[model samples]
Target: MSMFIRVKRKKTTYFLHCDPSETVLEIKQKLQALSENHVDDQRLILIANKLVLEDHKTLADQKVENDAIVAMTLKIRETGDWEEVVIDKPGEHPKPDTDAS
Candidate 1:
């Protein structure tokens, strides 16, 4: 089965869906590769929307599964609280068709 990771960017959160078998590092690389704007490693910090994402830690270690929200913080929030977003939601997007490329 595959899993989904939620990466929180500046004022927004991004969703990355990948194989559950993949490691955290793999996911980080994938995020950078897929991002429209360049994403630096120094800016990448994993923070679960509900909990914490250990550094260099794989998703499997947390017993995470499909459609999970794996929050990734790019920059330190302004309120000094990285718990909640300062802006609005990134908005819902239609799922990419599996039949298409």
Candidate 2:
């Protein structure tokens, strides 16, 4: 079955459609096409468990499921260090009333 993941970086969220058999490297390549960041300079972390994803491992192997939230970090050119994950969540919306009195 096809699934999608929410790749969040800063305030931007990328919805990528993928299959469970797809490797992490493939996901990086897809992100590279969209974000223009080299695959080598990209790192993905599963936010739910703070697990760093391996490039050679398939999504199923890593237990990344449908609608999973992955944080993308880029390597700094000068420092050669990966940037900290920063996902800017949007402001919460007020809940609708449910009372029927």
Candidate 3:
């Protein structure tokens, strides 16, 4: 029997089947296929417990169950420059800088 898990990325959520024996990397590949982002550029975090899933570990090893939600974030590697993923929520905007004369 296959288990289904929920994965959230920014404002989108995806439900995918979980293979108990598959490594985290394998799962990440499946996630990448479903997402526009690349597997190498993602950092998957379990939303329920805030655990970072390691590539070498299996889902069974991590004790992840059906309907688990994992949050996907862009993984930025150190390249001597800073790269950030900005999350823009609805109805929230950055305040403008106003200088009083």
Candidate 4:
């Protein structure tokens, strides 16, 4: 059975019918095809209890269930530099931190 997953990107929320057997990179590839971003630049941040997901892991291994929402941030290369974009939800203001750990 296909799992129903929701992906939030900036102001847009996309609902995807995904197979649990598929890897995280595969999902990122689909996102690349649907959006203006490239697959290599995509970063699928696993939001299940604030855990970071690896690209090679499958959705089932991540415990992603139906109707789960996945938050993604993109690292796009523009004009000879890489820009990291964090798509915050509405009414949430976050302070910018320059500390890279």
- lDDT: which candidate is best? 2
**Model 3 Cα shift for residue 36 (angstroms):** 2.9
TM-scores for the candidates: 0.52, 0.88, 0.72, 0.73
Q: Write the per-residue lDDT of candidate 4 for residues 1-101, one digit (tens) a residue.
A: 89888888678777888999989888888888788677777666656665556789998998888888787776644654334445668778777888999
Q: Record all residue pairs in model 4 with backbone atoms less than 3 Å apart, i.e. clashing.
A: none
In model 3, pairs of residues that clash are none
Better-scoring candidate (lDDT), 1 or 4: 4
Q: Between prediction 1 and prediction 4, which has the larger TM-score?
A: 4
Ranking by TM-score: 2, 4, 3, 1
Question: Model 2, poorest ten-residue lDDT window?
Answer: 88-97
In model 2, the runs with Cα more than 4 Å from the true position are: 92-101
Candidate 3 lDDT over residue span 9-53, tens digit each: 656777888787888898889888888677778777787787889
lDDT of 2 by residue, 1-101 (tens): 99999999998899999999999999999999999999999999999999999999999999999999999999999999999999887764556889999
- How close to the true structure is residue 71 of candidate 1, measured as C-alpha lDDT? 56
Q: How well does model 3 score by local distance difference test? A: 0.77
Task: Indicate the residue-level lDDT of 91 in model 2.
Answer: 68
Quickly count the clashes in candidate 4.
0
Global lDDT scores for all candidate models: 0.57, 0.96, 0.77, 0.76
TM match of model 3 to true structure: 0.72
